[model samples]
Target: MRLTALGSRLRTTAWPIPFVWTVALGLWGLSREGSVWRDEAATWQVALRSTGEISRMVENVDVVHTLYYLLMHSLFECFGPSTTVLRLPSVLAAAAAAACVAELGRRLSGNLVGLGAGMAFGLIPSVQFYLQEGRPYALVAAAAAVSTLLLVALLQGRRNERGRWIAYACMILVCGLLNWLALLILPAHMVTLAWARPTVRTWIRWASASVAATAGVMPLILFSRTQSGQVSWIPPLTWHMLIGPAILLALAGVGALLDRPGARGLSATAVGLPLLAVPQIGLVGISLFKPLFVDRYVLFSLLGLALMVGVVLGALVEAVGRRSRSSARWVLPVVVAAATVALLPQALAKRSPQSRVDDVLAAAEQVERLKKDGDAVLFVPSARRDTKSVSPHAFTGIQDIALEETPERSGTLKGVEWDAARLRTEMLARQRIILVTDAGDVSKPADSPRDRTKLATLGECFRPVVDEQVRGRRITVYVRSASDSPSRLRCSESSR
Candidate 1:
């Protein structure tokens, strides 16, 4: 009895060590990360604003990320502005998720499976990719994993424990709120529950929990629908979308390497198959019409893949040096370690600014070097202007000609734009105007709205002086044709 009690204590204590290591890895080099990604810049612009402004912004856009923005807002008020402060929540949430994966694995199999699964989750390149982000995807991944853990407890709990069931329902609702996309995991849970074939009362409890969670998430999805244009950038689904599922399947087959057959396989399949399939398949179905597919969107599903692999590896480890297990034991550890090393370079690159669409800091530096006091700036296609959002400090000496109100004042990521005529008038009044644009976008044969306006008016009114290309974009300086100035370029008179 004492030996059993000692074993329990050791197992419990062992849990957090892996959890802490996973978190430390996630948080590594976070402070040194340069040129916040465009998504993180969006967080900075929206979260630092007043609550009323944030509310107004979400009502028109990014309603999908409302809770995450509010959380960042609260953090900003308490800690002031810094990348670390903005992203620490994600780091902690991901750590909690890694730990939850371990705990859930232990419940399904044992400690060996739990430890291997948790470590695999921590080392997944995709997992590390999102954990360091300032956005809500990591939290989404965490919430999804935790909700699954809660479901496991609810399923196994005694009949008298109604409160655990209630907590499980509430947690599913919370996960949906974190990322409505997360609710897709529930269908997978439904499959698991169906496989259990519980008594009528158990079925009722499961039905009640599912209904409550669905009811809670409906309103969020409805509001998010109104702002659906925010994701217009997601191209339609293609064959590439199937690759995530393919990779997961390949990994699952690896776990089968140590399968004990029969009941072991069924149990693992019951837990693992649904997690790997339902969320992804549902998303793919939706993407058939909407193209909402991305690996990060279903990042939670990877935990299931990790758990399945861990179970097999654990079996091999436990049956050490016995018959076929002799070679399997040594091979499993080496394989896992080798897989992690293979992923390290790409994982490390994800930590650097190169992983993002553009280097906002580097572009901001060039703009600083070229601009004179009071120079006017116009960003072609407009959205590329997000570069300034992250380095708001560098544009102090210049003016945003098309910008009518700042992001904070307008309560939007890029701020409100003046009408085209007003923008043209503003541009003509300046001695020198700077153009910020993506290299490909700028070189396109067709003119974007802002591009057309800048070309039509600035073409007739001003002349290009000098232009240079930066990391992922181009910057040009246009000088007024020595004839266009507010004194000489007054709009009301010019129109007449």
Candidate 2:
């Protein structure tokens, strides 16, 4: 009995193992070979701004990421800016999440299940993708895991119930502030409440805590509606997106069946099943109303999936133990090892530059290489201005001929550009123009009149001196055609 007690104590402290393991995984290719995608470029730019600038920018756009931007801003102030400093918070947050999953599994199931779940959390593909990302999703995932652990502790009728409830509410609040979509976890917890069938008092306490947390984030939710255009780029829901959730649900369902959780118990299925399924289904439902079904929105739900994986591993151990006790001991390690080996290629790929849609730094490098002295730069559709915003050094002596206001001063991303009439007047004075834009395959049709004008004017008045495509971005150097007189430079612009 003492030996069993010793084993239990040792297992409780085993969270650090997964924590360390996840840290190692996160640090393995921490910089992604010094690649930063456009999304991270946004983070980097906003984070480098003053708090007042961030406040103004959020009021105009991207209010959803305000808290994360402020957090990163503070980090930047303390550490200065570098790829390591940019992504280190995510690495630490992911490690904390892995540790929380391990502790949750240990308390709810066993030491082995806890360790398996914790380790499995790091290996999950979505988790791995965002694990090194310099964004708030990983931090939200960590808060969600901590909140779930607190909820499990509350359900277990542990001491310090009041304090745990407060912590739980704070965790939810943090998650919501990071990204309000994380409030979906509340419905997930509601499912757990139904499964556990807690007493009236417990339910009231849980309801109060949940309500308090939601109320804290409600103002942000309402305010963000004004900035809804940030998400307008998300396409309408399609059948193909359903395949991923369907497979996830099917796998979790099998794990639930294998665990066969008892009614009204804080069993693995009781917590994990609801955690895994409810948020995903809830997001799908939201998508039905508005196309907001991004997989990363409910990334916290991966914890539920990891817990279920642990249950599945536990089931395998039990089945194998019936045949040979010694063999049962090998079940988890062997399975984890085999899974790791199978995922080796994917793991390496996630650490590569090609893992993302585009590399902002690589594009900046292309600008540095192709740029000649006194060349003026133009960003097609304007958003590509992020390349210059993220790497201002590469753009030294390069004029943004059309920019009317800087992004920081204008309280907007990508800054403000002159009207097409003024833009053409400005462009006519420039001898060499460096055009930075998306490559042909990824470039969207120029929607705004200004963008259309930029394209048409360049096509009519300039000849391509050098054009190169690298890492999903295109750099073209256009020298004004001497044969083209100002009369011939008359380019038509879209009326709208």
Candidate 3:
């Protein structure tokens, strides 16, 4: 009796083990020696900005995920905004997501499937990257998992369960608010329910809840549309990249369908088809315009992929067992164990700490030492530049011109509009300006013609004071020429 009780307890407790592991790994990822990356730095800046300022900032800026910023604002208030503290919420959320994935797998398949999916989730390299950052991706990941589980539950139910319907509604609403990409799951859910032969009342309840949720989320959708207009330079998507996830998803489907036990054909079709098909179709549609087929956007699909693999593998083991009882008994466990062993190395490497925090802090220190109360410090284009080549490799705290203009390339700064006249006014007011640019190697073309003029103008107004090399990158400091006026320049209204 005691042994049976212990077994039951272990079965129940298995779901949370992966969650604990994910959290521990996330914490380790956070402990890595890195400063906040560009997007993370931008999130911190926005969170720190005053509410009044945020309205003005958002009007000109293109930020799709404002709720994440709002949450970060609350976190910053509570924890006082250190990089580690700032990222803790995302790390926690990612860990919770892994737990949810495990639970979903267990409910749909069995304990072995659950364990494999959860461990895979905790160890996935891409998952680790987002978990370590102070961004919305991790929260989006958690919401995606919850939304999927609720969706599966809603479809499987026979009657109108008020609590389940309400839960589904809330999950949908939260998913929409957290990340717009979550809308992709709605059609998948709908198709799954339709195929399940749910009762008429169930359909009505689901429809009503969905419509109500959409109404609630309409304002945010409108805000996203308005914000989209500000980003004019986003390039159209290509066909090859859009179809990539579909192929990966298809592999998962084959694994699931071929491995299922008797009478699983309908269940497999219901879950697998929509999960794989909708994203592929959506990707094709989205690719025709600006490509929204980013890997993280379809993060929810990973759950389906894992489920498909687990079911197929489980079936294979069961099949071998029927042929020979002794062989079958050990076959499944050995396969799973071997798969786990193969995956362990990649998992450990993903969570390693090497974020390069020392670089940004060092640059901040240098700026402090060089700056005086009245001295002007101008980012050449008045935008943040990539500082990856510099020691402690991270983004400098300089603001970017706007999100629309941010470069598609990673580890480089682009899209800052420089106004020479405006720069001159600020410099003259302070009697000197410390001009900083990313080391030339990583600096891309300035975003505006005015930015190029400002670079040329800088040499004319100031003499180089210090040209130091740190971490193989040159950082030059220039002091204003003696002939330049201490008073600020007065420009025409148009110039300003």
User: Where is model 2 more than 4 Å wrong at Cα?
Assistant: 1-10, 260-264, 484-496
Whose lDDT is higher: candidate 1's or candidate 2's? 2
lDDT of each: 0.74, 0.87, 0.59
Winner on TM-score (2 vs 3):
2
Q: Which model is ahead, 2 or 3, in terms of lDDT? A: 2
Q: How much is the lDDT of residue 78 in candidate 2?
A: 95
Candidate 2 clashing pairs? none
Q: Write down the worst ten-residue block by lDDT for model 3.
A: 386-395
Tens digit of per-residue lDDT, candidate 2, span 192-256: 88888899999999999999999999999999998888888888889998999889888888888
User: Quick one: ranking by TM-score, best first?
Assistant: 2, 1, 3
lDDT of 1 by residue, 1-496 (tens): 0122222443774458558967887778785355575677788777778789999888877887888889999999999878888778888887888888888766766666676777777788887878888888878777777777776766665454588778778878877887888888889888877765556777788789878988998998998988888888699988976886878877776675654433223354566668877888889899999978877788888877877877776765655534443454465468667977898798778887767666556677878888899898888767667778767777888989898887767766777788777777787677788888776533454345656887677676677888887656678888877555564444333563
Q: Write the per-residue lDDT of candidate 3 for residues 372-475, one digit (tens) a residue.
A: 55554445444443332222113243322222243322211233333555544444444455555555655567776565655665565567887654322235
Model 2 superposed RMSD (Cα): 2.9
Clashes of each: 0, 0, 9
* Residues forming the 10-long window of minimal summed lDDT in candidate 2: 487-496
- Misplaced by over 4 Å in model 1 are 1-10, 158-160, 253-266, 323-336, 441-448, 455-473, 481-496
The numbered model that scores best in lDDT is 2
